[model samples]
Target: MKNGIEIMNVEQTFNGKKVLNGINVKIEKGEIFGLLGPSGAGKTTLIKILTGQLKQTEGKAEILGKDARKLTGEDYKKIGIMMDNFGLYERLSCFDNLKLFAKIYEITDDEISGILKEVGLLEAKKALAMNLSKGMRNRLQLARVLMLKPNILFLDEPTSGLDPATVDAIHGLIENERQKGTTIFLTTHNMAEAEKLCDNVALLNEGKIVEYGNPKELCRKYNHQKKIKLHLYDGQNIELEHDKSVAKILNRYFEQGLVETIHSTEPDLELVFMELTGRKLDK
Candidate 1:
């Protein structure tokens, strides 16, 4: 199967500092691939190189089978990109903003309206971009990308400060786009976001990939132990180690009426991130 995005020993440097060093990654077509890292970890630099906004200092990247640096205007029509720094025109109405971008991408009016509705912004079509809430602006940014119906999308920190419900809505939009055969490349520090949306993720730190794999696989690989939390009726919370011997003990505790509500705790993406990066993800 052909890959949607391929980076071959890509490297980048700025002011004599290596931001990316011999990076290699392959994003399969139709899969949501994530780049997980914190600020100043070269995540934005990598995205810029992948989207042809900046040239790699060494090696190469190919998007949709064409050298990323060699992409032309026609090639851009097949790609969409959203980043935190790229803001919309605050003075323009949402409808006009989408229409203008669609014109730039040579997308039809019908496609623009459809994308607006798809992102749940149809009712706010005529609302000025500045008048919309932060979450709404974020959704509009996504809608702008969808208007082109690009085969590949590069999203950087797609959900940053939004509430959980809005974040979930954005995730759903990404899923919807993926179902339509769009290949999504997501970059975010939010481990939960990556775990919820990406099929596979690469952990980047100091401008290099430290780990790469399925979220579940990485979590299981890094976490050799499991734990279970017991919430007692008397407001006492006790944690039990999960092992063969502990399993029997837990069963006996329940059988003897000593246990309360029990819940198993597995290693999540945040744990995996810490294991790989040697620092907590929330930090």
Candidate 2:
């Protein structure tokens, strides 16, 4: 809670329904912290509160020691947010979109082209925003956010609906940003993307954090059993649960020419989600 962005006991209610109940998180500088949750799980609401667009009914959210609810003009200047609903003007060219955001973020022309090229939109600079593909538009949105040269980035579903290639491009850009000392808070339903890019992740269920830790740590914690799978020379597949005996047996099998291929199996994030939350990410 002392470093990066902290949200302590944050709660929110909509009409008579309590959406977020005592939600808390502390994201560190230069770390890609992922908020993993299904749709309608209050991810967007929490993001709104953190960005000062909405007030929490109870508790507090802070960024770099500044109260999230009372963010100053300078605070806005240092944070970049790319949400699902942050619209791009249909009439503007991709370059113009970045140009407008550059003015808003007070960045100079000297840095705009570099940011565009970094996000792979330099080729689409003259294309109308409305004419871009969905993936291209998403990249343009991210490019617009980076125009601020912000220290902290709040991204909601950054790779949603993008093709595998576009997703790779976006992930590379995100890694590049983190390397440059940008703190990223990402909310996504894409568990694979989260596992690949996040340094730490929190599983949010019904607006509360059900679990939080490094992805590998969580996987090890939840996986009560491990299996060793092997392909035999006779084209038969064999599986043995991991144990001291299994290890010895596998070594002997390999030496006896009985093993062709082998792999160890542990529960993945999706399996862990079902074990912990009793539901799939898409559900």
Candidate 3:
């Protein structure tokens, strides 16, 4: 079966300084594949290589089985890209900004309207892009890209600055795309979002893929010191390790009906990433 996007030992360099080092990844058809990393992790460089904006210095990058370098302008009809600070005409209304893109891509108004509704921008269509809130601008950008139902979507930090509600709305739109069989390559530092949305992920460090697997699997693999914390009704708190259940003490509390609350602490994607990279995503 064709991997929607594939890279084999890919490398990128700028001014003789390498940015990506021997990267290898295969994003399956119709799956949301996350590239997780912190700033300066070469995530953007890899995206540029995949989208054919920049050529790799070594190895191969392909979309739909064709070399990235060989992709013609026509090939872009199958791709949608939403990078950070994606431009919108500040002077134009939200609808007008999308209209410009529609005219270039030859997208009909019906599709544009439908996408605006999908991204929850239908009500703000007449508002100037500059007048729209941050969340609204994000929706408008997503709508513009969705005007063409591309087979592959490259989203870079799709929810970086938005509030929780907007983040949820954006992810809902992403899920709809995933359901429609769009292969999404998402690059984000939001580890929780990655774990929640990705079918599989590659944790990228400075230039290399430090880990690759389902997010849950990676987290489980590194959950060596799993712990549980509980507060006792008797005004005492205790921490118990998974491997060493600490049952003798816990059983005493259990028998005495003295447990007030208990919480199990499983390793999350952020902790797992930190374990591999020696730093958190924000840092």
Candidate 4:
């Protein structure tokens, strides 16, 4: 609440239909919080409400101790948002596109160059936005936002439709921001991304949060099977409950050099989401 984001019983309606329902969450300072759900799950709508783009139909939302609905221009300056590539100027070079925002934020040329390098876009700084690849365009957009050096960053599906390598690069950049103490609010259906990047996540479904907690802890909490799966050198596999009864068998296999690998049957975020919502996180 002091230096982070808080939403209390927030709800939203479009026309006569409700989109968000009784959503509540608290994100700590310098934490990466993920709002995860499939398409049409109101992830974007919740972001809009928090960012002051759209007011919630009911309840309160606050960022950095100020009411979201009353956030001023100065308050906005402390926030960076990269929701889409629509902010890019197709005719302008990447450098020029960033320069436009630089002027508005009073950022120096050296800082702009530094950000370009940081986002791995320095070499393509002079390339037109329209001519850049999708990945490069995404980086440029991220650069524009990072130039502000905002305390809070809102990234909605930052790596959607990107290749694995590019997604990794983007993830690295997000981690870099996290190291600098930026509070990141990310909305993605990618459960792997959430597990990799978030300190905590809220699983949203049908405009409501069905689950919320640390990603790894949530997975462990729902590990109903609690089995230890083992693969043997002889191409045989075995699963045993994580109980004292199986401890002797596990040790015997190890002593006999038959175990090749072992893993706990911990459910991942996708599986947990499915179990709770009866729907896949991707769909």
Best by lDDT: 4
| lDDT accuracy of residue 158 in candidate 1 | 85
Worst 10 residues of 4 by lDDT: 79-88
Candidate 2, after superposition: displacement of residue 51 in Å?
A: 0.7
Q: List runs of model 2 lying over 4 Å from the truth.
A: 1-3, 257-260
lDDT of 4 by residue, 55-87 (tens): 899999999899999989999899998996356
Error of 4 at 92 (Å): 0.4
Best model number under TM-score: 4
lDDT of 4 at 226: 91
lDDT of 2 at 282: 69
TM-score, cand. 3 vs. native: 0.90
- Per-residue lDDT over 1-283 for candidate 3, one digit per residue giving the tens place of the 0 to 100 score: 2649999999988899888999999898999999999999999889988988888999999897889888887788888888875688999997788888889888888777788889888888899988988888888888877777888999988898899999999999999999899999999999999999999999998899999999988888897767878998778888887665577877887898989999777688889888887899876
On lDDT, the stronger of 2 and 4 is: 4
Report each candidate's C-alpha RMSD, comma-separated, in the order given.
2.1, 1.6, 2.3, 0.9
TM-score of every candidate relative to the true structure: 0.91, 0.95, 0.90, 0.98
Better of 3 and 4 by lDDT: 4
Candidates' C-alpha lDDT = 0.87, 0.87, 0.88, 0.94
- Candidate 2, 1-283: lDDT as tens digits: 4437998999999997888999878888888999998988889999999999999999999987788999888888888899989999999998888888778766777688888888898888989999999889899999887878788999999888889999999999899898898999999988888889899998888888888999888888886778888999899998898887897888889789888899777777778888888988767
Off by over 4 Å in 3: 1-3, 231-236, 243-262
